[model samples]
Target: MAAQGLSGFYGSVFRRSITVQVLIRTRDHRVLLLRNGNAWELPGGVVKGGEDPRSAARRVARATLDPGSDVGRVLVLDYVQGSQRQGQAQGQGQGDSIAFLFDGGVLSTSVSAFTGAGGEREARFVPLMDWSGGTDEGHGRRWGAAVEALELGTVVELVNGEPASAGPVPAPLPRRMMPPLEGFSGILGH
Candidate 1:
């Protein structure tokens, strides 16, 4: 009993986090890119507990990019194994990551006029072919897959550059189909 307790208490705890990211295009065939410094990442963040990833994509956009934009179907899903910051202090935690890449479609307004509301320093629309930085930061494949998804209007399940799942993704349920909230019965059109 004591041995089991020691093992359980001393073993590393597994942590996992889900993130929702979106790719938004422009009418002129450009993609909206946000820059913080030398590297610019696609828009996304960690999904909150109990919050669905689909809606989380929209919420992330509203918090950063256009506030009223609609998030379309998921473009791609990727799973990255757990990682730790090299040379960090001991006892720091490492966690697995699951990410959903959603198609945010085109921006309703011009991409240039708007500055990023989040920590992003600036926002600009760049042509797909000339997106110089897209190939770096292990983002080339993700960007490619996302653009392909946008073009095909379908979802792809990718596990480390390989398609792991086949077939199209089902459309999201309408508001009526979703279950009503607790304590709000009868008022929500039961």
Candidate 2:
């Protein structure tokens, strides 16, 4: 079947979502990542209806990190397509998502402070060179792209980690990594 234009596609109506992620880093090269269910990932989730993406980033940071933590500019925009019915003949359509990976400025938190809750389990700062393994993005998968975004000073668009689109972002985002900070602990108290 031929693809319908934007108007026709809108008429059909399919579910799409906007998600926000924080590529949190410490003074060290480690990345502040999370594990939900089985995969290791950055701290972030779906953006609420009518809620600003930046605010959502801060909210996610507050919930996952210290309330005083800062949420920086977006580093990457990812368009991830949800799994479609494998055997669909054609034109059945599939779900997709638009994700914004924000630069979660260094939030000096401790590893022991990470506690599992609300479907999020084991949140910690993992060194970029390590990949203990758990979920797809647990290792350097998401972190690597985030690093590239910060270094290149551009918004990297990826469809499941492949080039697909392009968008403008801050000229140059900082590349702070994981390291032990002396003050300002995380909000997830032990």
Who wins the TM-score comparison? 1
lDDT of 1 at 123: 70
In model 1, state the lDDT of residue 8.
47
For model 2, residues 28-124, the per-residue Cα lDDT tens digits are 6667777666666778888998898899999998888667876888887776655532344444455566778899887454563366566446877
Residue 77 in candidate 1 has what lDDT? 89
lDDT of 1 by residue, 72-127 (tens): 88898887554432344554565556779888787555546356455335777778
Instruction: Kindly state the number of residue pairs that clash in model 2.
Output: 7
Candidate 1, clashing residue pairs? none
Task: Identify the runs in model 1 with alpha carbons over 4 angstroms from their true place.
Answer: 1-14, 83-93, 108-114, 118-120, 132-137, 165-190
Model 1 TM-score? 0.68
lDDT of 2 at 7: 57
